[model samples]
Target: MQPIGTTLKQIRQAKGFTQKDVYGDIISRSFAIRLESGQHDLTAGKLFLILDRLGVSANEFRFIQNDYQATASELARSQIMLAYDQQNFPRISHLATRYAHSDNPAERQMAVLANVLIMAFDRREMVATPAMAQLWQQLTLTKTWTLQEIDFGPIILVLTVQKKQPLAATIRKYHLACERYVSAEADPFHVMDARAAFDLVALQLLLNHQQYATAQQFKSQLLAGETAHFTSDGNLDQQLSLWIWEGYFGDPTVAANRAEALRQIPSTRFKLGIDTLLSTWNKRAAAYHQRQK
Candidate 1:
C-alpha cells in the first residue's frame, strides 16, 4: 500500500514525463508538485486528465485498492461460511465479539455478515441473550450502518437459512420486501436507501444461484438513479450506496460522481468514508490495468 503520493510520483517517473511536460502552462509547477505529493486534492476531471497524460489506464489506477477491498470482503465471507459449515456456534460467537471491537471497515463488514448468519440459523434467540443484546445496543448507538455495512446483514441471513425450511422462507420474504421497496418507490427517502435495499436483495439472489447477469441488471437500475439531484444530508446515503455499487461494478464515471457528492456533503465522517472508497476504487482500477499488461 504505497501512499497515493508515492504511487503518483512513481508513475510519473516511470512514464518519463517531467512535471513541466504534463503540467506545463495548465498548472503551476509548484502546484503540480503539490498534487503529486498529495498536498492538494484534485478535482475528478483534473485527476482524469492527469492520469491520462501520465498514460496510466483507469484500471491500473484502481487495481490495488480494489484488490485490497476484495480480499478483505472475501476473507470475511470465508470465515462466516466456515463457521456455518462446521456448526461452530462458539466460533461464530467469538468472531462476532471480535467484530464488535474492530474499527477496520472490512472486518466490521465480516462481523455484520456473521451476525446475520447467526440470526438466521441459530435464531435471534440463540444470540439474543443479555450479552449479545448489550452488544447490539452498542452497535446501534454507534450509528455506523453505512450502505456497505448493511450488505452483509442480508447475506448472513440468507446463508444461515439456506438449508432450513421456515427460516429460509422468512429470509426470502424479507429479501422480497426489500426488492419491492426499491422497485415500487418513485422517490426514496435517499438514493442510498434504495440502493441499500437493492444491494441486499441482489446479494441474496446471487447467493441463491450464480446469477451474475441478473444481479448486474439490478445493479444498472441502481446506477440509473445516480443522476438525480440531491442535497447534502438529503441524499448522502443514496450517493454513498451508489458509490459502493460503482466500486463493485467497475464504473469510473459513477465513482467520480460519488466523489463530487461527497465533496458537497458537510460532514467530516461522510467525506472521510467517501474519500477512502474513492481511493480504493482508484487503486483497484490501477490493479486491473496492471493485470492486463
Candidate 2:
C-alpha cells in the first residue's frame, strides 16, 4: 500500500487540486503540508472536508482508512513484542495507540488487551490508559470469546510473581468463562473450541514464564499420557509444550531426546524451530545463572 502521504497526494492530483486548493480556506497551507507529510493529525471532520473538496468519494476514503488501520495493527504488534522482550512496559503502554487506530477491530482489541496483560504479568504499575480501559470494558460487556483472551488472564497472573501460587482473581474470571462454554456440552466441534481456548492459555502461561517443571506436571495431568499422542498429531500446542520442557529441563541427553522427537514429525508438516529456540534459551539461561553467581 502507498504511504499516507503518497495516497493523499494522488487523491489531490487526480482531482487537479493543490494542497492550497483543498484546504485553502479551512487549514493553512503550512498545516496541509504537515498533514501530507504525516506530521499532523487530521480529525475525521477535517479529513472529510478535505476529501469533499478534492472530489474523493466516501467509498475511496474507506479503502484508505482500512489500509491505514491494517498498517497500524501490524506495527503495534511488532512494537508490543519488542517492548515485552526488553521489559519496557511503559513503551508497550505507549504503543497501544497504534492498535487503537486499527481498522480490524478484533486485532486492535487483542493488541491492547495483550499489552495490558503483559504489563500486569510483569508486575509493572498498571497504567490503564483510557483506550486500554475502554477496550477492556467493551470485551467484558460484549463477552467476546477468543483463545487469546482465555490465555491472557492466567498467563499474566502466573508471571506476576516468581513462585507458584493460587490463580489470581482475574485468572479465575476467565476460567469461569471457559467453564460456562464447556458446560453447554456443545458439539465436539465446540468442545475442541473450548479446549483450544483453555490449552493455549495454559501453554503460554507455562512457557513464557519458564515454568517448565510446573508445565510438565500440568501436561501430565491434562493429557494423561497422551502427550506423545498429541505430539504425533502434529499439534502446534503439543509441540510448543514439549519444546518448552526439553528446552528447560533437558541436559545433553534431553536435547538428544527432543531432537529425536522432532525427527519423527513430518519435516514438511512441522516447522520445528525448537532447535533454534532451545539454543537461544541455553545461552540466556547460562548467562542468567552466571550473573547470579
Candidate 3:
C-alpha cells in the first residue's frame, strides 16, 4: 500500500484542491509538504481534520490508497448478504479466516463480525465469545459510534435476542444512531444511507423476539404515518418489508401478496430476507398457538 500521504495528495489533486485548500489552517504548508513527501506521518487527529477538508472519509482514503479495490473489511461486509442468501457458510468462513489476522483493527472487527453473522443469520444459539463481549464493551463505552460501529451494531442486537439477554441499552443505542441519521442535518450521506437498514434490522429482530410493543413503535416511526422517510413511496423493497411486518402485526393477506410480489422478482436481494422473516413469523405463531393449547 502507498503511504497515506501519497493517497492524500492524489485525492487532493484530483479534487482540484491545493495543499493550502486541504491543509488550510489544519497544518502548516511545511508539514503538509512533508506529509505528502512521505517524510512525516500524520497523527490520527490531524489526518481526520485534513480528510474532512478534502471531503473524503478515512475509509475512502484508504480505498484510494489501496489501488481502488475494496478493503478487506469492505469486501467482507459487501458479501455478508450474499452469504446469507446462498447459505454459503464455507464462503463466509473462508472470509473470516482470511482476514482474522489483519493488522488493521477494522479488518479484524469484520472477521469477528463474519463469524457472528454466520451464527446470527442462521438464528443458531450462541455462547457469548470474548470477541462479542469486547464488541459490546466498545459499543457501550463509545458515546458516538463510528460508521463501522453503526453498521455492525445490529449483529450485537441479533445475537442479544438470540441469547435472550436484556435489550434496553443495545436497542437504545441502535435507535439513537438511526434517529440521528434520518434527520435532515445529518451528514456523511453514506452513513445516513444506513438509517433505513438499522431501522429494518431492529424491527425484524424485535419482532422475532416477540417484543411486539417495541417493534410496533419502530414500525410506526419508520412509516411516519405512511410518509416515506427512507425513500420515495415507490421503493418496492421498503414497501414489501413494511407489508410483511404489517401482515404479521396486522393484515396477513396484505403481507402474503407483498411477499409474492418480491418472489416474482428473481433478482431482488430483498427476497431472501423477506422469506426468512415470514418463516420467523410462522414459527412464532405456531409457538403461540401451542402455548394456547
Candidate 4:
C-alpha cells in the first residue's frame, strides 16, 4: 500500500501535475499529500477515480506498484507449470495446500485445478471432488465471467463426465465461456489456441456422450475461428484433431484437407506416423457419429 502511494507520487511528479490538479476536489490538498506520502488510504472507488485522473488503469498501477513483478495469479500459474514439468508432485501438493486455505476465491479455485492436474499426471481416475463441485457451483452461479473462470471449461467438463453429473450447469459454463472467448484476455494467437483447445475438448466430450447437436455447435465455433497457421507440434496436433472432428460433424471435404494440413508440420515426436494417427482419429470420429444413425 505504501508502495502504491509512493509510486503514485512519483508518477504525479513525473507527469508534471501539481497534487491539486490531479486530486482537485476529490479530497483536500493536505489529505492528498498524506495519501501520496503513504500516510493514508483511499477507498477503491476513490483510488480508481484518482488513477483515471492520473491516466493509469488499475492494471498499470499494479505493474508499476509491484516494480514490474508478475501478479499473484500469474506467479501461481508459473509455479504450477514449473512444478508439473519437473514431475514435482510434492511441490504442487504444497501449492494446493497453501492456496486451498487462501481467503481469495481465485486461489481456492486454482488449488482445485492444481489437484486435478496432479491426478491426471498420476493416471489416477479423475473425480469431481468437493472442491471441484464448489468451483462448478461458483462458476455456474456467477453473474459474469472473468478470463480465468471462462478458462475452466475443460476441467469442469472432465469432472462432469467422470461424476456422470447433470449437464445443465456444465453446459451453461461452456456456453458462457464460448461467449467470453470472443474477447479473450490473452494475446490474439494464444487466445485462439486456448479457445481451440477448449472447444475441441468440449466437442469431444459432447460427441462421446453422443450429444451431436451440442457437438455441431462447437464444430461451427471451431470453423469460424479456424486457421492454417500453427506455431508448435501441439498446435498442429490440436488442428489435426479438430479436422478429424470436422469430418464427423462438419463438411467431409474440409476434414479431408487435414492430410494436406499434416504436411505443414515437418514431423512429430511420436513413433506412429502423423498420417496414421490422424487416420485413426478420423475413423474414430466417424464411428462415434455413426451411432446417431
Winning model by TM-score:
3
Error of 2 at 166 (Å): 6.2
Better of 1 and 3 by lDDT: 3
lDDT at position 38, candidate 4: 87
TM-score, candidate number 2 = 0.40
The 10-residue segment of model 1 with minimum total lDDT is: 163-172
Error of 3 at 168 (Å): 4.5
| Per-residue lDDT of model 3, residues 132-188, tens digit only | 677767766788766666777657676566556766567666657655555554344
Q: Rank the candidates by lDDT, best first.
A: 3, 4, 1, 2
Any runs in candidate 2 off by more than 4 Å, and if so which? 1-99, 103-107, 113-128, 135-216, 221-234, 246-255, 263-276, 282-293
lDDT of 4 by residue, 5-106 (tens): 788898899899898888898888888888888898888988888899999878778887887787766677668755753457788999988988988776
Off by over 4 Å in 3: 12-36, 40-55, 85-87, 97-108, 162-164, 185-187, 224-237, 269-293
Residue 140's lDDT in candidate 2: 53
| Model 1 misplacement above 4 A | 1-3, 12-30, 37-39, 43-45, 48-94, 103-109, 123-150, 153-293
What TM-score quantifies how close candidate 1 is to the native fold?
0.36
- Pick the lDDT winner: 3
Could you report the Cα RMSD, in angstroms, for every candidate shown? 18.8, 13.6, 4.3, 6.2
**Clashes found in each candidate (C-alpha, N, C closer than 3 A):** 21, 1, 0, 0
What is the alpha-carbon lDDT for the whole of candidate 3?
A: 0.68
lDDT at position 239, candidate 3: 60
